[model samples]
Every structure is written in structure tokens, then in C-alpha cells.
Target: MNDLETRQLRYFVAVAEELHFGRAAERLGMAQPPLSRAIRDLERQLGVVLLRRTTREVTLTPAGEVLLRDARTALDAISAAGRRARHAGEPTPRLRLALKPDIDGGLLPRILDAYAGQEAALPVDLVLGRFGEQAQAVRDGRADAALLLAPFDDHGLDSEPLVTEPFLIALAATDPLAARPSLRLADLAGLSLPDGSSADQGPASGWHDRAGAHDDAATASIAQDASDLPEIFRRVELGSVVCFFPASLTRRYPRPELAYRPVDDLAPATLAVAWPQTSRSTAVAAFVLAATTVAAATQPQKRETPQTAVT
Candidate 1:
């Protein structure tokens, strides 16, 4: 309704997410009675039953489910608007870009240099995040653009592909498979892989998407969880788990104990520049153009299919 306030939506979202009035109240830094009254009043004004409650528990009605989804989008948009307004008011507003370290396919420096020469370029602000965080940062207006890998969630964003490189399987050098010239995806069917869903893992870990082996039951059963690249390398060296990584990683993080071999049938990883679909900033446009141009000049036009090379 036009009469609905952002505060009411915020209150509703907290309760809907927590599913407990007391917990939501505590989260919102308020007491239970007033929170309960506010929800009741909101339902009356909307002429809809949003929640179903009992002494034992709380649940969302069908309408409430729909509201919860839409409410989050609305709240994010409101927050973005406020952020943008404040940023615009600054005397020298910088263009915020989000990315994960070592995931840009080694094109970041060139891209930055290229953008610096653009007429509309502004000072770039780098916002580094872990895996699965760049897209949301763009969506919520925290960053103007991002450099991300492919096979990521691209909803509510527009992106341009920069470079695509084949995948390599990282395993203990002592493992039998490491001696092979090249391995097929089927060779890893029964091996344990890293769980990308681990909170500590970032996209740069090389196994964030699990690529071609995601559907394999054995691969799905996580062998170990790691927080950073060195930890992942340690697990691989110890034969705790095998991982799929973009070919670029071999050059960046070559290790003596770990061997990298190409997977013949595995899918390749693409690096792209992404920004909010609704973005109109000239700085964002210039940055995207600069990134794509630098990629075209510096990256190979066609990557050779995986062969027996091991690093």
C-alpha cells in the first residue's frame, strides 16, 4: 500500500526471518509487546493475514511468504538509494569496485591503468570480499562494479565477459592421478572435494563452484573445509581433498607439494565485470569498457584445450 512505511517493512522482515517475536524484538533492540502490536497493526492496514502464530511457535502464511521475498528487495533498494544520495553529496565521490583477490585472471592492474586514462574516470575504491559476496555488493549499491568469475549468481546484474580459461585439478603430487598426462572428469568421480558452502572459503579458493564434479556424489561429500589458499593447498598436499581451479591459479600459486593437471572434460572459468542492472554512472561504464578492452589486448583469443601439462 502507498501508506506502508519502510519501518514497518523492516519490522516485518526481522520477524519473518527470525520467526519469533521476542527474538526479532531483541534483534531490533526493542521489547516484545510493542513489536507484536506493530505487526498486528500492519496486518490490519494491509487487510491480509501475514503470519500465523501459536503459543508454541510462529509461521508465515502463504501471503506472508510472498511479502517476505519482496520486502527484502524493497529494503535493499531503499538502503541503496540512501547510500547513493550520500555518496553523490561528497565533493570527490569515488567509484567503488568489488572483487576477490587473485580471481581477476591477472587483468586487474591493466584494467585499472586503462580506466585511469578515461576522461570520466574517478578515483577507484577497492572493496574486497570473499566468494559469493561481490554480486550482493553490487545489488545493494555498496559497489559500482565487480570483477567476478563465471558460474556465479548474476541475478539483478549486467555483466560482460573478459576472459575464459580452462580448469585444472589440484591434487597431492604423490597421488597416482598426479602422474597421469591428463585426466578426465570421470577420474575424479569418487574423490572428495572442498565444500564451497563453507563460510570461511572464498571464491578464489579455486573450488568455489566445484565445476564439472558438482553432481558427483563422492565429490559432493566434502573431505575438508579450509579458510584460505594456503590451507587449501595444505589439504591438497596432505591428500585430504582434491580441488578444481582456474588455470590462472597455477601461475599465481604454484606449490611444490601440490600438482596441477588439466581436466579434459571439465568446464572452464570465465572472468567478467558486473554491475547493477539499473546502473547509469558514467564511471561504471568507463570502467567496464576499459576492463573489456584490456582483456582483449592482453588475454589470448582462444585457450588451447587441456593437455598433459602439470605444474
Candidate 2:
């Protein structure tokens, strides 16, 4: 019998994880036919039928199941071995980092500075994504680590809050709700972010959404603005949605009628730096170090908050 190769193991794992050939191919950044042939090659080399393929789905056979577990262990070891070799050759530690737009404030500038001080060779590749997607990226091995806002609790993640941002509501200049100062979530209810369209139009898309947006036209959607966004702002920026965001973003990007008001009831978004608990990559650690340094900065500022005696 021929010894199993790492490429076959990788292909098998990808198929197992996706459970769909088309999706697995997309995830692997390849096309479908080649992937199918590769899977066939892997099965032939192993001398066992690993997958049961049907018109719509794929299932692992018993032999495939056993190989899947062993494959993951071997792949992990191979990846670790390579990382170790790279680390030994150079003291520099750099990794791919993910940042979702929702996690605003002090961290961005600090992350940039932290990675820049690296050994002139170690480099950090920062990937941008939505707030909801960052944790998945880290879990899937697509990113070494991420800066995120919490309420995200995953079995694989190890997270520590770096900052807590206050939520603020945003409204269009012409909206009636914008007339009110310092509105709450209740006040913003029933209001929708206009898709940069005239307000006289009724029952737009996402009308059922109490907190989203409305647009008469589907193809002509507007991109929500947030050159500076807080945690709440992140949600709004994603759609024709009137959502709240962290207060710091309001101060950074001032608008006369893009009114911002404090929402008293909702929990303030907690900005956290997170990684898969199982990851021990130097790249992951260095990414954490850069993000955590932002936390350390947050700490000193917290200590500096003036103490007021409760009489």
C-alpha cells in the first residue's frame, strides 16, 4: 500500500468539513471537476471508499470516518512543524489578522503601531470583514486572530474584552425621530434608514424589520455611511437600517442631521480580541499581543477616570 500524502489528507478534510463538493471547491479556491477527481484519487490511493456521494449530498463511509480523525491530527502536526521551522529561522512573529468594522475605536491605530515594531520581517496581514463573520474566520483557520465585539461566545474561542463602547442611534435629517434629542431604542422603533431615497414612499423593503431600512428599488440600494463607526453603527452601516453604534464613532465623525442619541437600555457593545483556544501559533500570539496592547492602553485610561465620592 502507498503511504498517504499530506495533499490527500488536506483534500479529505476539506470535503469532510464542507460536506458539499461545490462548496468545498469554492472554499479550497479551486474549481469543481478537479476537486472531484482529487477526491477520487485520494480514495483510490487509500484502497477504501471514504465518501458516499449522491446527487445532492456526500457522506463519509466508516473507513473514511477513521481516516478523517487521523488526517486532522497529521495535518495539524505538519502545519505546526512548518510554523516552528519558520519561527526558529527568524525571531519575527507575524500572522493574518481579521478586523470587523463594528469593533471601533482605539484599537485600530494601536494594532497598526504594534505590528510595525516587528523584526522588520514579520508582517501582519489584516483582513476586513463584517462583525458577525470575524469569529468564524478565526475558527476556520482563515485568520490568526480578530478584533471583535462580544455577545459572541463560541466553544473554540478564547476572548478578553479590550474595550466597552456606548451605543448611539442614527437617523436621517428629515425623519421625525431625528427631532428628538437623546432617543432610546423604543423611540427609534418603527423608524427605518431611508435608502437615501425620498421618504414619501411607503412600505419599503425590510419594512417588517423594526430596526432595518426601506427602499422601493432592489438594485439601487444605498451603502450606509460610517467612515467612523461605533459598535451600534456597524449594524446600521450594513443595511438601510437605523441601528445604534458606539458613541466614540459619533464624536469622530460629526454630522448635523445624522443625529446620534444614547440608547440607555441595551448593553454597551464589548470590544474583544479573540482567537481559537486551540491555536498556539506564534502568529496568533503576536496578533494577540498587538490587540492586547490596545487593551492595556484602555486599562490606563480607565484608571485615570476621576473618582467621585458617593455622598
Candidate 3:
């Protein structure tokens, strides 16, 4: 059997992710013909049709989807290997922590301070990411670890629990639903949810993962996409879409037109720290320990059973 090369996997991943040959070729800084040829050759080598290429669009077949996920893991591992080698030669290396801004319930600064106070603590570099981008930051070797909302896809990552808090539904103040003191997932069944930043195209698997993890609730289709949080809020205020947010976010970004209601049925959103499975740095381990320690210490003493780490 012929083994696939890293270059081939890289090409396939690029094309699979973009689902557009021309754009993928542009991203790879290569001509379109060779890119197409490489994908064809890869398909022959694998003895499976990886993509369904039409004149109008490029879509992944089931096999192609599986390959894309596996290929991404392989590419991330290769990149991580190179990054670790480069960092090994550096005299003083820092740990990069990626997170979405303003979602940590003010626990970020405390965790950083606690970690910095630890012995042999490495300097921490903060990498702020847009919604649904933190996992990629760690996978692509840009971040050593990520603080993410949970029920996230943990395919190639190790995650530890940090905090758990109830969620709130964000809706327009003028909407009749806002008059309720609290609600459940079923309450917003048919109302569309703001998918994500327009850059991401739609409500990513992360949203679905969080929403559908342990529930039997009906989901809403993507009614709108916003480029940023403000745009999402404006859309909500305009009564076009709705969204679910961590309870902490409501305290941080209060708006006159935005009303938040306690969501009683959905599982509490769990904030977790995740690192790539390929990460073998002691610094990253130390940081994870520091974060878990601080998180555990901050929670009330009455809670005895600790949250298990997600492998």
C-alpha cells in the first residue's frame, strides 16, 4: 500500500476545508490545475472518490469528510512537531493561551496571576480569537492551550473542567418572550438563532455540540450571520434572531434592547481548558494544572465531586 505524503494530505485538507478548488489553490499559492491534479492523484492512491466536484461547487463525499477530519489531525500534528522543534531551540519560551474575549467570567486574570506566581511558570501570551476559532488556534500550533465553551469537539484535544454556570437566552427586549422571567430550550424552538460571525458562514458544530449535547430540543435554522458581537446584538434588537449565551456574558455586555432570561432546561455551560493531544510541553501541563487549581479553589466548598477531565 502507498502511504500518503504530508504535502498531499495538506493539499487535500486545504481543498476539503474550502470546498472550492480556486480558493484552495489561491490559499496554497499554487495554480488551479495542479491542485486539481493532486486531489485526483490522492483519490487514486486512496482508491476512493474523496470529493464530488461539480462545475458550480466542490463538496466532500462521506469518505472525503472522514479523510478531511483525519487529514486535518495529521497536518496539525506535523505543524506541532515543527513548532515544538523551533521552540526547543529558543532560550525562553512562552505558553500561548487562546480564548474568546469577555467570556471567562472574569476568571482569566485570576488564573493568569495564579499561574504566573507558580514556580517555573512560563510567560503567558494571550491569543484572542473569534467565535469557533480557538480549537483551530491550538490545532494549528498557534496556541499552546485554549479556554473554550464546552461540549466542544474534543477530537484531538485534552480538556479539563474549569467552571460550570447556567446559560441565559438572549432575545430582543421588544419580543414577547423577553417578558418571561425564565425559559427552557423548547421555548425558543422555532425562532432562528444567530449562527455565528459571517466569516464562519453558519452556526458551527460548536454551537450544535453545546445545544444538542444532552437534550431533546428542536433547533432553529440559521436566520442571520453577524461579523461581530455588536452586529449579533443589533440583529437581536431588530427581532430577527436569538442566541444563547453564558450567564457571565450578560453581566459583561448589558444592553438596553437585549434581554436575558434564565434557561432552566439546558445543561449549564462548562468552561474548559483544552490543549492539543500532540502537545507534550511541561509548560502547557503546568498551565493547565494552575487553571484547574484556581478554578477548583474558587468554587464553593460544598461541591465535593470534581468534574472529570475530558480526554
**In model 3, where do residues sit more than 4 Å from their true spots?**
1-3, 18-32, 46-66, 196-227, 303-311
Candidate 1 RMSD to the correct structure: 8.2
Q: If the candidates were sorted by their TM-score against the true structure, best first, what order would they fall in?
A: 3, 1, 2
Clashing pairs in 2: 213-240, 231-246, 232-244, 232-245, 233-245
The best candidate in terms of TM-score: 3
In Å, residue 232's CA in model 2 sits off its true spot by 12
lDDT by residue (1-311, candidate 1, tens digit) is 55889999999999998898987898799999999999999999989999999999999999999999888888888888888888888899999998877788988899999999999999999988655678777877888899988867786789999999987888899999999988886677567656633222323434564432333345444422332667778888998778777788788998889899887766678889999888899999999999999999976569779899789
Model 3 weakest lDDT span, ten residues long: 211-220
Model 2 compared with the native: what TM-score?
Answer: 0.54
Q: Write the per-residue lDDT of candidate 2 for residues 153-204, one digit (tens) a residue.
A: 4546798777777766666555566677665545544555433322222212
Tens-place lDDT per residue, model 3, 44-82, is 988999999888898999999999988888888888778
For each candidate, the alpha-carbon lDDT, in order, equals 0.81, 0.63, 0.77
Steric clash pairs (candidate 3): none
Report the C-alpha displacement of residue 202, candidate 1, in angstroms: 15
lDDT, candidate 3, equals: 0.77
Query: TM-score for all predictions?
Result: 0.76, 0.54, 0.78
